[model samples]
Target: MSDTRPWIYSTDHDDPDPRTPEPGHVYVQLVGGPLDGQLLDITGYTPEERAHGALLMSNHGLHGPGGRSDYEPRPGAPDRWAGAADTT
Candidate 1:
């Protein structure tokens, strides 16, 4: 059982969404057996952001950091909880 879903928890915005990977922020990669099959392609962020998640997708999303993004929360999605943990 591998965990491929990566995540990033930040305090900059109380409740940060894992789907929205920001640059310069810290995150964790779901590597290993327990999470090998749950992968979320987050190339929409930036190279640095994707690096934070450790997700290496094809060249279909953002490459580097050099743009302004207005990330809006998805409709009907539950509000992200705020807390601190091992964002590795």
Candidate 2:
């Protein structure tokens, strides 16, 4: 199967939010992707900020302290490209 795993993003250094987050809930880049690969761009940040490579909103619902089904992003919407900002 294609790799469709969920990538977890968090702003907390130690303890992240306990509640599960819906897909598309963006967290600024706390880290960067590989140097040679196409880094997923995220809005709400600068090029340097995007260079950091923010987390993609996971399709797999919530996780850990935040159980699945706890978060829900704008379902049935097209995936937003990186560098896009939250309009709402």
Candidate 3:
């Protein structure tokens, strides 16, 4: 998956909001495929994966306490990503 957009986190709601992700929360924008532009929460990734995911985000110029990035959507599986393993 590729990071091509800025990562943003919204801190307005009491509960976890897909529209507004907080620290430790990851929001990825899916690119290409049926789920393109869809925002996904990837907080369920393994610790190692999360670290790598953060690095990927950084490489794409997305930097912040929260893990967020614009990701290239995986083929076939809209909710699955090759870069970030879906443990859930």
Question: Where in model 2 is the C-alpha error above 4 Å?
Answer: 1-44, 61-88
lDDT of 3: 0.43
Candidate RMSDs in Å, in order, are 14.8, 14.4, 13.4
CA shift at 42, candidate 3, in angstroms?
0.6
| Highest-scoring model, TM-score | 3
Quality of model 2 by C-alpha lDDT: 0.31
All candidates: TM-score: 0.23, 0.20, 0.32
Candidate 2 structure, TM-score to reference: 0.20
**Please, what are the lDDT tens digits per residue for candidate 3 over residues 4-86?**
44333333346444354557765665543323344557667676554343223322222443433434335555444444321
lDDT of 2 by residue, 4-41 (tens): 43333432446453233446644322122211112222
- The lDDT of each candidate is 0.32, 0.31, 0.43
Whole-structure CA lDDT of model 1: 0.32
lDDT of 1 by residue, 1-88 (tens): 9534344422234554444556654333333322222223343566554333332322222333332212222234322111111211
Error of 1 at 63 (Å): 33
* Shift of residue 73 alpha carbon in model 1, Å: 25
Stretches of candidate 3 exceeding 4 Å from the true structure: 1-18, 47-88
TM-score pick, better of 1 and 3: 3
